[model samples]
Target: MPPDSDPTEYKVGRLIDKYDLDGLGQELEDRWLGRGYESQSLRSLADWFNKYILEEKFNRAGEPPMDGEIDNIYRLLTDDEVTSGMRLDAETALEEKDIDPENTRKEFVSHQSVYVYLTEHRGASKQHSSKDRIGSARDTIQRLQSRLIAVIENHLEQLRNAGELTIGEFTVLIDIQILCEDCGSSYSLTDLFDRGGCDCE
Candidate 1:
């Protein structure tokens, strides 16, 4: 019920009731005039409506961008700023969907994570391949070998005097064929006691 208020304000105020920006603006304008502030144009009022009030209610707080917010999701996907696979999904969802952007951003926070994609196009969970498993095993075995070597070096003198068939330097010179057939791999033993060939017999 502001003095000199627009008819649209009163009508819109009734439509939204307790949550009416039109009435709020009218109240403010009346108060400013009462305090003798100079009148401003409706253009500024419209700007305030679009920039502050409308933006706060519908656009900010990590809400997804409006439809057509993105010109091209592919461009964002290949952008240098986004570097991980998970981030790619999130960035795309934010660009194309109507979900809150904050949650979308969280989705890409862990790229290495495994989860169901819950989309109409793809389905099902899968385990890593045998080759991947083998690679991991090899890495673990190498780490174990390095640790054993450290232990041997720490007690090198004790081991050397034990006279109990120590692996010798020449053992490392064994032919690759012999090394593979006899020991399964060259990693298991040092050349200290290799018989030079796989045909030790």
Candidate 2:
């Protein structure tokens, strides 16, 4: 383990060991920390995990999965925007493969899980990120954004378990919108930053 590595064993680390996915940890670290590689967001990392690792694993199984079967089913089951019909179809598809939907669902992991695996378990660090003021601000905002989501998720789960509210699958939205009083127009925080400040005379 690296000197900066955290000692906690995360869920993703256990899953990696369970699947015998050798070299995956190093590859993820390389992609994240290697110089000259483009910066990766948690979303992109999630996509990479699903496509190159998870889906690929199923493709190599004793009984080859139908082309795109794993991707489609997994998406329908986990995607926040998916409809009820889509989820039902995914379950049916799993049944066709002689897989139990409920049990299989337990094996899926999210992008956040991948992040924890790489950071806490693998001791991966972002060695290539810019260290300038603007870069630091951007990184701080990104992490805080993630923490905000996690906090809300935990509180919502607690409420559900306490029977304080009745809710189904939900999406969490945290849009920071700024209204330009001069122009009487609204813009997202990111858009404002990207445009180098709102257009004004």
Candidate 3:
């Protein structure tokens, strides 16, 4: 899934539909039985569990969710919906500027909060500069977006090829990463996959 949606929602949904079932071994075999999903392998799922789920290396000890992390997720999901509103108001106050959507996208990507947003949502970084450019500035922004998407996609492919996660498990791992990055909270990898009470908190 892209970065604009709630990664938690995406991960949880996949867990319920795919990973939360019997015969996980069979399922893993089936995932690899066909060509593959995005070039992922069955071994990838095992590897992912071993690394992120079994190893539990997602966070530093004694960390808690931080401020503005929700805002970070919101920005990534809604293209900084809150920030865009605020900036539009500010732009109206300071100048006769019309709110350019492209400008807004660039601003969100450049914001310090973007790191938290990008790290978790796999494709959030791809949204950095995908607007149509009418002028040099817009064109420049598009170029940046193109380069960034390539890099992010490459990273995702590498993660997939590492043979450490299943498509389903990998999504959860990513969601955990994003949640941690956004909230600055450290969670055990086991705790993340645990369906006992893993609500958005």
Candidate 4:
């Protein structure tokens, strides 16, 4: 079976379903699976999703959830990587919408909190699978690597937009470097995969 959604991701992201953005998690996962994983980066995946899927959602709704005042505020409030200014802006946005910022902040949940929401509150099963290790390891590793890169890029953008992080206005560059525990040899993730894994193994 394909991996189910991670609760950690849900915690770190916007309240996906609440703002008429249902199916976003599934859409992201589905597109990433069908996309050319070897050539496409996670950032590319996100851009595609936003331009196509998210934009459609915005348009079809015919209006913002709160006359455009509550646009993405819930997400910004919850995103831990957002800069202080960004967080302030989200709170201000909420105030404009006549929502209690403190109450919303109090509602901020971590992954630990949502795990309880799922299994206990929602009566959902917690499922875990570890099978076909040899066959699936590469796919899992690549997916994880891509996810990390995209996550970093997102945080960087938040900081830059808030003027808290400066990088001379250049895009962040990331490369996955893997080191073999047994042989003390290092390889780029792409090169390692292309060579069918570590030579030491």
Expressed as tens digits, the lDDT of each residue in 95-187 for candidate 2 is: 665666775566555556665566656666553356455446644665676578679978998898899978875434465678999988787
lDDT score at residue 180, model 1, on the 0-100 scale: 60
Runs in model 4 lying further than 4 Å from the true structure: 1-71, 126-201
Candidate 4 at 140: error in angstroms? 19
On a 0 to 100 scale, what is the lDDT of residue 41 in model 4?
Answer: 29
- Candidate 1's C-alpha runs over 4 A off are 1-23, 31-38, 58-201
lDDT of 1 at 123: 22
Badly placed stretches (over 4 Å) of model 2 are 1-8, 34-39, 51-61, 128-134, 141-201
- lDDT tens per residue, model 1, 61-174: 456446543323423433457657755675556545454544322222110111111001112112236677543443354345435544655466456668754754210111
Question: Model 2 residue 56 lDDT?
Answer: 48
- Supply the TM-score for candidate 4: 0.31
Q: Count the backbone clashes (under 3 Å) in each candidate.
A: 7, 0, 10, 0
Which candidate, 2 or 4, has the higher lDDT? 2
CA shift of 18, model 3, Å: 22
**Best candidate, lDDT:** 2
State each model's CA lDDT, in order.
0.35, 0.62, 0.34, 0.49
TM-score of 2: 0.59
Clashing pairs in 1: 167-192, 168-191, 168-192, 168-193, 169-192, 171-191, 172-191
Best by TM-score: 2
lDDT of 4: 0.49
